[model samples]
Target chain A: MVDVTAPPLSPTDRSTVRRHRDRQRADRAELHAVLDEALVAHVGRVVDGEPVVLPTLHARVGETLYLHGSSGAASLRGDEPVCVTVTIIDGLVYARRWFTQSANYRSAVVRGHARRVTDRDEALAAMRALVRQVAPGQEDHADPPSRKEMAATSIVALDLTEASVKARTGPPGDGDAVAAGDDRWAGVVGLATRVTGVTTCPALPEGTPVPAHVPTG
Target chain B: MVDVTAPPLSPTDRSTVRRHRDRQRADRAELHAVLDEALVAHVGRVVDGEPVVLPTLHARVGETLYLHGSSGAASLRGDEPVCVTVTIIDGLVYARRWFTQSANYRSAVVRGHARRVTDRDEALAAMRALVRQVAPGQEDHADPPSRKEMAATSIVALDLTEASVKARTGPPGDGDAVAAGDDRWAGVVGLATRVTGVTTCPALPEGTPVPAHVPTG
Candidate 1:
C-alpha cells in the first residue's frame, strides 16, 4: 500500500470522476489502494492523429506510477501526454434490468505527461518496485538487472498527482424491485484472481521443489 | 467464441503489433478469445489535445466491438478515433534476472473510429450481448431493457477490422540458467479469475434461492 499520510487526490479539472460521480473516492489512500492492487495498466497515447493504447506491467513507487515495456514500445515516449488506467473487477452485478447490469470494480485513471526515467538509480529502483509489485518476495530472490539489461529497458513514470478513483460495490441498484413484491433474482456474484498452480523450470532437476516465496495452488 | 470461420485479422499499418513482435497472434479466433474472456476494457480517445482512457463494459458482436456506458460518458463519441484494449493475465514469470521477469498475458489492442449505434434494434442487441458477455446466462433471466432505459444509455461500436493480439506463454525465458550451473528456481506462477460466492438480494425473502443459472462457489 502507498503511504497513507499522503494528502488527498488533487481536485484538478481532469480529476473529476466520470460515470457515477457519487461513487468517487476522495481519499488519497483510496487512490493508492486502487493503483497498488491492479496488475496491468492500459497506457494511452496520441500517435500522430490516432490514439494508441496498450497494456503494460505497472507499479506504484510512492507518488509515481511506473509503466514497463520493451524499449521499442511507442507509448513509453518521454514528455508526451498519457493516460494510465487500471481496473480491479470485484464481481458481476446481476441487476433486474439489462440496462442496470454492471460490474463491481475499483478503477483509477491517472492523466499526465510521461516522464522517461533516465536516471540509472531511479530506473533501477522503479524496476525493483515493479517486480515486487507483481510478485512480492521475488524481488530479493531474482537477480537484479545486469548493467547491459538496464541499458536495453524502457520505463516511464507518471505523477500520481492528477488522478480519479471510482468504484462500485454492494448489491444491485434494483434490489428495490425485490422488496416491492418482484420475485426476480438480483445480487452480486463475487469474483477474484487466484493462483491456479506453479510450475518449476523444466531445465531444473525434477526434485528442485518450489520456493517458499512463490505462491502455489 | 467468435465464428471460427471468420477471416484472419487485417494487417493494416496501425494494426502492426507493438512490443515483442514475435508474440503477435495471427488468428482471428485469438483476438476474439482475448476480447471474450477479459471483463473490462480500457477505452482511449483524444479529448481536446490530450488522451483520456476509461474502463468500460465491452462486448463483441460479430465484427463490431460494443462498449456500454451512460450517455454522459464522453468516450462514447460518434466517428471519433478510439483505442480499446483488453488484457487477461495468465501467470507471472519468475525469471533469473529482473529484466527477464515478465507476465504471461494475452492482450488485444483495437483502434479505429467509434461508430455510435443509433439504430434501436442494433443498440438492443448490443446491450443484450454486453450483459451476456459478463454473466453468460443473465441475459435471459434479467428484464429486457425498457424503452426509456434504452434512451438513457449510450453504446459505441468499433469494427474489429484493425486490431492486434499479443500473448506470452510457457516457462520463464531464463530456464537455460538452471542447466548452466545455476540452481535458482525459475518458472511460472499460474493465475485465473474465479467465482468466490453468490449473494442473493437482501431485500428478497430469506432463502430466496439463487437461480440455477447463477454460479455459486
Candidate 2:
C-alpha cells in the first residue's frame, strides 16, 4: 500500500468543515472511487497575483494525487504556494429556481505545498501510472517518454493528506425556503457519457483495426 | 424570439486559432457544440491574489455569455480582468505512451473584462434565462426570485468578445518518435454522460409524474 494518510475519510481537524451540502464524505474509499471514475479535473492556482485554472489530466495512486502539465504552464512555477481543486460533475440538477440549480457532483479540494517533480524515476512512474489509470493497459502500448520529451513536460505530485472530498448527489436540496412549496418541477438532468465509433485519421493508410477499448455506445 | 442576441457561434480573430494541432476540424466544432449542449460552466477567476473557480450555472445567448453567482462569492466582487475558461470533457483519449495520455476535451478560454449586472431588470432576466437555459422548461415551474433574494445574489454578465477555443478528440496521437518498435494494447477509454433514473425528494410526495422536460435519460 502507498504510504498515504488522510483524515478518517470524514472531516479532519486541520480541514475546513463547510456545510454538509458542500462537503463530500471524507473516507479514502469514497475519494479514491470518485477519482478513479473521473478522467480529468479542473486545476486552480494563482500566479503573479492572477488566477489561472487549467483543466489537466490527473490520477491517484494510494494517497498521492499526480498532475501533469506542459513545462510552459505559468502557474506551476516554483515561486508560490497553490491551492488545487479537482471536481467531477457527475450530473446536472435542474431545479425550478435559479438558486437551487446545481450539479450532482463529487469534488475534492487539496490545500498543500506544490513542488516540481524533480525525481525523474518517480516522475516516469507517476506518468505511467496515470496513463494506465486513464486507459487501462495503455502503458505497454505507449512508447515510453524520451528523456528530452520528459524534460519538456512537468509533473507535480501532492500528498492527499490535507484534502476533503465533498459531494451532492440525488435531486436538489429541500431547504426550508424551498420546502414551503412543492409545485415546481424539481429533478436532475442526467448527463450520459457516450463514445462515438472509432474515428480514423485521414493520413493513416487503410486496414487499422479499432482497438478493443474504444467501444461505441 | 427572446430578443436575446445569440453570441457568434465561433470566435472570429485569428488569435482564436488553436496552437497545438492546428488542423483538426473536430476540435473546433466540438468546442462550440460542447458549450452549447451543456447548461452550466465551471467559471474560474481570481480574487485578492487567490485563485478560485466555481461551478456555476451559465448561459450563452448569442455572442454574450452570462454567469450568475451569489453576492457572497469572493471572486465575483471585483472588476479586474479575468480569464474565464469553460471546459467539457467529451471522452478519455487513452494512448500508447505515458506522455501521450490525454483527455478528449473541448474548452474555451475567454480573456476580457467582466461587468457586474447592476440593473435589476437585466439581472432578473439574465438569472431567469440562465435557469431556463439549463433546464429548458424550469423558469415557469418555480417561483421567481423575490427582490430580497435577488439582492442577496450577484449576477455578472461578461461579453464573449475575445475568446479562443481548443479541443482534442479521437484516439491518442500516435507518437511517431516512439511508435517505431513498441507494441502494447493502445486505445481510448470512453466515458459517457449517463442520466440515471430520477430520485424524487422525500418532501415531494410520491407519483408526481416526472416532468417531461425533466429528462429521465
Candidate 3:
C-alpha cells in the first residue's frame, strides 16, 4: 500500500511537466499506483556517452524502486544517472476530429542515479520483492536464489523522490461541434492486460493443475 | 503490410543488441510486426544533458516512423538524437528457480535523429496516418485537422533503417534440474491487450451503434 500521507511530488527543474500540464498528477498515491501495477519498466541511461534504453522487470518496495539484471550488462554497472519510466495504456480514445484522437494512459518517470546493491542481505530481499511482483504467490513455491546465482546478478535501487506522474482518463475531449455531430461515432474503447490461459512445461505431468496465482481470462 | 523482401535490418554502432544477444531477431518482418502491433512508444532523448523518456502514440508508414505532439513539448522539439522503443509484453514466465523467472516480450529500439516535419502536406498526412494507426476505420469518419490545429502540432519522423528487435517467446528456459522437478508448478500465464467495451459521449444520440473496428471482449 502507498503512503498517501507522504509529501506531494515536488517538481524539479527536469521533472516539471511542460506538455499536457493538465494531466500531470501531483498525488503520491497516483505515482505509487502506476509503479505497483507495472510489470516492466524502461530504464534509460548514458552508456559510453550515448543514450541507451533497456526494458527490465522492476519492483517498487515503498519509496525505493528496485531493478535487477546481469552484472555484465553495460547499463547495470555502477552509480550511473538513469531515467526509469513505466507506462500503462488503459484505453483508445476516438474523436470526431483527427487532432483529438488519443489513448488513455498512466505514466511515471523517475530520474536519479541508480546505486548498485552490493550488500548480501539487501540483494536477497530485493530479489524476493521482484519475484513477488510478477508472480504473486510463486515466491513461496520457487526456491530462493543460490549463493552463486546471487553473486552473478546485480540489483540497483533508485530513490523515488524525484519522479513525475502523468495520466489521461475517460472518453475523448472533443469539441462541442464534433461531439454534437451525429454523422460520426466518438467514444473510448477500453483495454486491459488479459491473461488468457496458462501453458505448463512439457516435462510436467499430464494432469498438473494450473496454479491459483496464475490469472485466466 | 511490411515488405518482407526489404533488406534485412542492419545494426549500426548504437543499435546493436548487447544484453540478450540470443533473443535479438534479425528478420525485418518481425521488426515490422512489433512496430505495427504497438499503439504507444517511449521516446527517449537527452534534454539539458539528462535522459528523458516520454510515452506517445506512433505510426509507421513503409520504413519511416512518425510521431506527433504539441510544439510546446520540449522532448519533441529540434532534430536531436532520439531513441524510440516499443515493447509488447506477451506473458509471464514462472520458473522453479527464482533466477530464471521472466516475461515473454517483443521489443524494438530505433536510434536516430528525428527531423521535424514543417511541410504542411506532409504534416497533414502524418497526422492522418497516426489517427489511422490507433483507430483504423475512424480516419474516414473524422474530419481533418484545421490549418490552425496543424500549426500547433509538430510531427517528427524517424527512419527505421537503424533499429534492433529482441523477443522472447514460449516457456521458460529452465535448467534440466529445475525443469524435471515435479514439486512445484512451472508455466507461462499468457497475456494480451483485450478490448473490453466502449463508452460513448453523453451527447451521442440514442442507439449510436458501436463501430465494427472497435474490439469487443
Candidate 4:
C-alpha cells in the first residue's frame, strides 16, 4: 500500500489561506471529490439584515451549482446577494489535546449572485442535474414533472466564483504536543451516510416490484 | 427488529414547530440518537451585515451545547445574536424521480444569545465536555491548557432554547408511478467515514504508548 503519510503534492497545496491550517487545501483533487459526493449544501444569506442558512439539495455541474426551492421561499427568491457554502466532513480529527483536535473536512465557500432560472430548458436541465446528483440514475426511470409541479418549483443557479476549498488531515498539527512526545493517541473517526433498504410508499400497490433505482444503499 | 416503516411517533413529535413535513422527523428516537453522537457543529451567524457560518467544535451535555472559538474572532466576540444549528446527515434519500430525491438528515436549529465564557471553571468544564463529546475518555489524559493558552482561546456557551429537530428517511416519493409500475432503478447509495487507525506524528519519540482517550467512532 502507498504510504498515506507521504505528501500527495507540494507543501503549498496544504498551506492555509485565511486562518492558517484551518483554511488550507490538502489537495485540489481531494477537494473536488468531496464536492462531487455531497447531496446538499447549506446556503447562508442576509435578507433585510437577518442571517439565514437554508439547507437544500444541490448539484454541481462543471463550475456551477443548482439549487431548487419552493416559489414562495423568501430567502431563495429574495433579491439580496448570498454566500453559499458546501461542506463534507469525511472524518473527525481527534488529536491528543483539545486545541489540536479538529475535523477532517472538505468545504467550498462561494460568494456569488443568486440568479433565477427563467429559461425553461435551462431550468429543466438544472433540475435534472440536481436529481442526478442526489441519486445518480434517477432521471430516466420516473415520470417527468408535470406542468403544475414545474410551476410550483423555483430553481436558482450560483456561479462557482470567488470560492476557496479548505481541508485538513493526518495525525495532527506539525508543532502540537502530540508531536512533542505527548503520550496520547491521535487519529480520525469516520462517519458515513447509509441507505438501509427500499421503502415502498403506502400508496403503492401491494406487489409492486422494487425498482433497481429504489433499492436502499 | 422493529418495523421501521411503521409510524415512529405521534404526528406532533414527528413534525417541526414550523410544520414542514420535508423537515419533520420520521423517527423521533432516531433523531435524538443522531444528535447525541456528534461533538462539533457549524454555527450560522450574521456579522457586519453579512452571513458568516463558522465551523466550531462543540459538545452536547444533556440539553445544553458548549462551543468555543477565539475571542479575537470577530464573529464570536461581537454583540450580535447568533443562530446555531447542529446537523447530522444520516443518509441520502434516493427517489425514483430527480425531484423527489433528498437527503436523510437530522438537525437541531437553535436561536440564542452568543454569550462569552468568562468563568474559569465553567470554561474548563465546557472544554472537557467538548473533548469527551467526540472522544469519550481523552479529556482526563490530556494536559490542562496553560494560562496563556486559556487567555488566547475564546469559548462561548449557547443555550439550547428555542430549538427544533427535523429529519427524513427511506425511499423517494414516486407515488402513482410506483403503483402503476415503471422500469427504472431507484435506490440509495451509502457513504460513510471510515477511520483507518492512528498515524503517529514524525516528531513523536519512538514507542510512546498511545493514549486511551482517542475517539474510535
**Which model scores highest in lDDT?**
1
Give the DockQ-based CAPRI class for model 1.
high
lDDT tens digits, residues B1-217, model 3? 7655576775475676777789889888898999899888888888767777888899988888999755674668748788888999999999888898889999998888888888888788888889988889888888888887887788999989888899999887773654444546688899988887888865677688877876655
Sort by lDDT, best first: 1, 3, 2, 4
Task: Quote the positional error of residue A206 for candidate 3 in Å.
Answer: 1.1
Candidate 2 per-residue lDDT over residues B83-176, each given as its tens digit: 5666777776656556676777777766556778888888888877787776677777766787777887777777766566667766657635
What does candidate 4's lDDT look like per residue over A173-199, in tens digits? 633564455555555566555554555
Better of 1 and 2 by DockQ: 1
| DockQ ranking, high to low | 1, 3, 2, 4
Cα shift from native, residue A25, model 1 (Å): 0.3
> Of 2 and 4, which scores higher on lDDT?
2
Across A44-116, the per-residue lDDT of candidate 2 in tens digits comes to 6765565556666777878787887554534364334445566666677766566677677776666556667
Alpha-carbon shift of residue B173 in model 2 (angstroms) = 2.2
Q: Which CAPRI tier for candidate 4? A: acceptable
Tens-digit lDDT track of model 1 for B93-185? 998889889999999999888988999999999999999999989999998888889888888899998888999999989887876799988
The DockQ figures for the candidates are 0.81, 0.37, 0.66, 0.30
Over the stretch A1-217, how does candidate 1's per-residue lDDT look in tens digits?
6655576775697678666888899888898998899888999889886778888889998899998855664647667989999999999999888978888999999999899899999999999999998888999999998888998888899998798899999888988786567898888999999999998888888888788989997
Quote the positional error of residue A206 for candidate 1 in Å: 0.5
Interface RMSD of each: 1.2, 3.8, 1.7, 3.6
Q: Please state the error at residue B133 of candidate 2 in Å.
A: 3.2
